[model samples]
Target: MDKNELDKRIADLQAERERLTGELDKARTEARDAMIAGQKPGGTAAALAERLSIVDDALAELQDRTRSAADSAERNNRKRRAESALEATSKRSKLAAAVDEALNALASSWDAYADALRKDVGQVSGAGGDLTAVERALTNNRAAEPLVKALIQSGGVKLARTFGIDTPIRERHAISLADAENRVAESLRVELLRVKAESPQPNVSREAQAELEKMETAR
Candidate 1:
């Protein structure tokens, strides 16, 4: 049996022993009271003693078995943990390799990238986002998982910089997925309001536009 099962059995045996002990004590008291009063006792003190002894023997044997089971269970648990850690580490390496492969493939497809860049009319600027929480989370495994995942999925060329795998993404954004989503949404709404104000369409009624303005004001 497993350690937990063994422990439960041990607990049950101990409970039974406690119950028997209480009964045995009451039996002895009754027998003593009857002898003092010069009458036959109703108590079965000998039978109770024999039952208690049997329980004691069983409890002792089960406790010894549990000690060995506990050690074996602990060893097996650690073994699984060690094996799982190796697999996790291997997968981590594979993930990094996959990212690198994607980067290399992108570099190979340079003509499309050049065309997109040349056609881009957007202004260039740094994101200047705060990285305080991300930096702090690095030392903590539980906290870092989601943070690192969000950073990778945020879709920047210099994700390596966030984890110190490469240089800093200077003049570039180092934002998590949630923050990136918020920024994209906010930027789009602002542009929508500006366009609606500049050239009011038939569909963009005054009341609808007022709600957008209200949202801006609330923020």
Candidate 2:
């Protein structure tokens, strides 16, 4: 090919390499922002992989064009430009991988925190009931005041402190006291069963020995 034609091809490859480098930079920035914003696990990794694929394609094209260019100063400049683009792409890929790992860790932390909160709140609310039920039960005059106080404090004193309410007791009514006590007992029973089932231990003799012996004989 003519010198002029070779120079034009080299220039085109150089421009394409620069464009790909810019795209890699943009992708790395986006991935970093997503990590800071606490994106879900694997999202950043997928994005980084996509950007790396583009970089690989552009690098291959740059290499082919550089090899076909005529031996001259223009060819040397294009080769240097290709090398710089490859280096930038490599750096951005590493940065993207780091960001993805960080975001995944953050997502795991958030999930663990949420799960713990759910368990804590569930303990206070009891089965088949909401926080309001627990609050009303605590208002009953018949309810054990110490137990009620512990429940309120366990749910975080900040809630009561924020609303300027008493730590142990809120507004109480005499008429609903009996009903509240009954509801509280039922809720506590259900919660106790749930806890027991979650951590059950073997009790070999809880049932009648005759029935156990019969079952053993049958086996």
Candidate 3:
């Protein structure tokens, strides 16, 4: 396909993905509201959840297609001059290896402390600010919160600070894009198990029920 056609298709797919995401979000919100209100969700919640899952699958497929199309178009548009320019740019990137090594060290440090940090931050670690800020700071090897900076500097391989209060070694230490995500998933699984145990017989729809089962099996 021509570049213009490929670009248009990518854009259209992205728009559809966004729309589906919004719908899924709305459905989740409604389901949460119902649970908070102590209302027994009839079939609507279950159906909404099923529809959301289907939309999520479609979105994933569309994103893969969009990326493939964009890549093909870029390759089709590449020329000898562009190749030479890219090669020269890569050769001059002296800081690339240093940056990669630094980030790897930070990720390792974070992994060492993942369990403690998860307990301390709770769900906030997965949300905005804390995890995002810490990860960004680590990636650039820039300064972040005093504790995080110290953690990165230590390479997550040794002690950086001591707490007067009694605490476990893991809590006192630090360690990814992938590493960070894995930690979050680890924390989430723990939280989900706790929630499932505490909130037994939750009056949710079949869709939510299925999702809960999936969460249980995530690890």
Candidate 4:
């Protein structure tokens, strides 16, 4: 049962008691009117007393029923309150469990992201030695000059355009590659740390704790 249902029951009982009281008052009034009417002929005091006694007894019975209804209403109200409290506690416990799962998932995702960043940085760094060797090979061969110049011109133009650099061809290529590599490394490090920092910590809401206590009491 819920509070609203209990309140409705109490209201119905009160209304019924009021109706019974009204009926009892009406009965007493009718008895008095009868005695008054009887006074005209054979209006014996004994007859009047008997009619009044019956009215009194009926009124007492109605009063007893009214009292019994009030007591039942009070008991229902107490039961409803206890049930409502128990339900609220159960809901809160379920909510807390959901929150705990969400936090654990978030932490797991952050850890995975950090691991991926570390792998990406390692792959990029492994290419650094190979890139340096290519630069050295281009620098030392004069007989291979035309081929090197053609390669530089074609690659430099594309690299410069892609990187948004407007410098001399050789300088632009070198600067763009170094800058891109450094930026990737730095970005990976920063993002990994940010994910670690944003990971959820252990904590619980006060309302959730209170609800848990209520559930324990019910058990």
What C-alpha lDDT values do all the predictions have? 0.64, 0.55, 0.57, 0.53
For all candidates, what are the clash counts?
0, 0, 8, 0
Give the local distance difference test score of model 4: 0.53
**Which residues of candidate 1, in runs, are more than 4 Å off?**
1-15, 34-47, 90-219
The sequence of per-residue lDDT tens digits that candidate 2 reaches over residues 1-219 is 555665676577567657666766777677788779997444554655576677567657655655665346677899899999999999999999997997698469645644554565555554554344334333335543433443344444554455454554642322233344455565565455545445545342333344444545866
Question: Model 1 clash pairs?
Answer: none
lDDT of 1 by residue, 32-111 (tens): 99999998987498888999899889888888888777788789999999999999999999998998997687556434
Candidate 2 lDDT score at position 2 = 58
In candidate 3, where is summed lDDT lowest over 10 consecutive residues? Answer: 160-169
lDDT string for model 3 (16-131, tens) is 65776677677777778888999864555566557657656765766677688778767867866698989887876757877678779867876665545556564565442235
Model 1: lDDT equals: 0.64
Model 4, span 159-186: residue lDDT tens: 4455354444363334332343455555
> Per lDDT, what order, best first?
1, 3, 2, 4
Candidate 2 wrongly placed segments (more than 4 Å): 1-71, 122-219
Q: Which stretches of candidate 3 lie over 4 Å from their true place?
A: 1-6, 43-49, 69-219
Superposition error at 18 for model 4 (Å): 17
Give the clashing residue pairs of candidate 4, or none: none
Candidate 1 vs. true structure, TM-score: 0.35
What TM-score does candidate 4 reach?
A: 0.30
